[model samples]
Target: MKVKFYATFREMVGRKEVEVHGVKTVGELIDYLAEHYSPDIKRELLETPRVGPNKPIDGMILVNGHNVLHLKGLDTELKEEDEVHIFPPAGGG
Candidate 1:
């Protein structure tokens, strides 16, 4: 599977995209990234929003353009042909 990183996430991982193997779910993917790259990647990808529902992470994880929140969250299944997009928490003035 191909995972794409955006914004500060790309900087955190030091790459725009990567090809991962053997991860079957979003959670597994995050674990794989943390194991291979920075351990901080897990916290960045799975932070809980301070003032929202106490679930879904603060950032976004998408599979084939569909937000994982709308699919199965961390349990969302992944396929080799699927494209995963990871975006850091949005911020603006």
Candidate 2:
């Protein structure tokens, strides 16, 4: 799978995209990124803890142009051909 980083995430990882393997779910991919990239990546992706049964995410994670929050949050499944995009939180007025 090709994981693409946007905004600050690109700077944190020092690249725009990377080839990730051995991860089947969005959560697993985040763990892999934190290990291979920086711990900040994890911090930016996941926020606080699960509220009830919903996983609260800090930023936006999209799988094939679909928001994971709308799917299954971090538990969203991934495929070898899937394109993952990660974006940090944005604040504008």
Candidate 3:
């Protein structure tokens, strides 16, 4: 499977895409990334270690073009060739 990052997430991994295996759910993928890449990514993406709702990070986490928040959240399932995209929270009015 391929996990693609955008905005700040892209900066965290220092790349736009990464290949991963042994993950079947979006939550698992996040766990795997936290272990191998940076734990901070997990914190930010998961919205943990946060303060109120004004944090600098709060983005859309998508799986195969579907918003995880509307699905099963981090429990969203994944299959082979599935693509994950993390986009920084939108701004401006």
- Using Cα atoms with residue i matched to residue i, what is each candidate's TM-score against the true structure? 0.89, 0.89, 0.81
Candidate 2 ranges beyond 4 A from true positions: 48-55
Residues 1-93, candidate 2: write the lDDT tens digits: 999999999999999999998899999999999999988998876754433255578778999999999999888999999999999877788
lDDT: the better of candidates 1 and 3:
1
Candidate lDDT (C-alpha), each: 0.86, 0.89, 0.79
Instruction: Residues 14-54, candidate 1: write the lDDT tens digits.
Output: 99999998999999999999999878888776754442555
Determine which window of 10 residues in candidate 2 has minimal summed lDDT: 47-56
Best by lDDT: 2
Give the CA lDDT, 0 to 100, for residue 35 in model 2: 97
Model 3's number of clashes is: 0
Cand. 2 Cα-lDDT: 0.89
Q: Which pairs of residues clash in candidate 1, taking residues 3 or more apart in a chain or in different chains? A: none
